[model samples]
Target: MFFKKEKDNFPAFLLTSLVIILGVHIFALLTSLYYILPWFDIAVHGMGGFWAASFIYYLLFYTYRGSVRMPCFIAFVVIVSGTALVGVLWEFFEFAMDIINIPFLGIGLSGKAVLVDTLLDLLMDIAGGSLAGMLLLWLKKNTL
Candidate 1:
């Protein structure tokens, strides 16, 4: 098998990340918080980054559980890189949504607003990834 079958808290971490992302997203959608609060989108993008990073980290941890050693720096790099990739893809999705003039989840803006929003989203994504990386490192140091 490529990955060792194991019991680990990684699953719990991933589940919690997913729950936070989805919960916040649903709340934002239901209450139009994304429109009412300027920072809501930023927070959602941050959580998206966290979720993406956690998924990538969990996959690596699972894949190398017994056969390979992952240094902290490497883990941090992978988590951030993976989150960036997902963030870029998500931006593309938003661009497509804008092209189609979709509501709610779409950027729905032109020119400067779009540029600023995209940059902020990317920044928040990286920030969230960094936070996740630090958390994972701490957990690994103490528990794994």
Candidate 2:
């Protein structure tokens, strides 16, 4: 019972970790906005799959490690749901920015590709998040 408090404290760490994870999403926000000749544009698009994969791995760790005392089923659900929500939001943000005359650090905007590209964003977001999660497990093991 002594450690119960510590385990319940997972939310704090989870939120911090998620914030850092969300920072990557923030970068995605920048990338989506950089419509023309954007920065590292090719690598960004290609790495989408990898990032989604990490999200998967992150969930795996949350489940396996997090479930020790309390069932992590809900954590898993929350993580997945939250990631998906972010992915959808990215699309909306991109589409909205294009329409609202928002400037992307001087990069010209493009709106015609919003629908198709947003779908791509969703796909890559899933892939990248899932992969990142899995890789994190391996990373923790190696570091330890």
Supply every candidate's count of residue pairs whose N, Cα or C atoms clash at under 3 angstroms.
0, 25
Return the number of clashes found in candidate 1: 0
Candidate 1: list runs displaced more than 4 Å: 1-7
Q: Model 1: per-residue lDDT, tens digit, 1-144?
A: 112332365687678768878888878877888878989899889888888887887777766655656788988998899999999998999899889887776867788999999999999999998898888667766664
Judged by whole-model lDDT over C-alpha atoms, candidate 2 comes out at 0.51
If candidate 1 were superposed on the true structure by all CA atoms, what would the RMSD be? 4.1
Q: At residue 48, give the lDDT of candidate 2.
A: 48
Q: Estimated TM-score per prediction?
A: 0.85, 0.46
| Poorest lDDT segment (10 consecutive residues) of candidate 2 | 1-10
Top lDDT hit: 1
lDDT per residue (tens digit) for residues 39-88 in model 2: 43334533544444444534554557654332344434444455566677
What's the lDDT for residue 68 in model 1? 50
Compared with the true structure, model 2 gives a TM-score of: 0.46
Shift in Å, residue 47, candidate 2 = 6.1
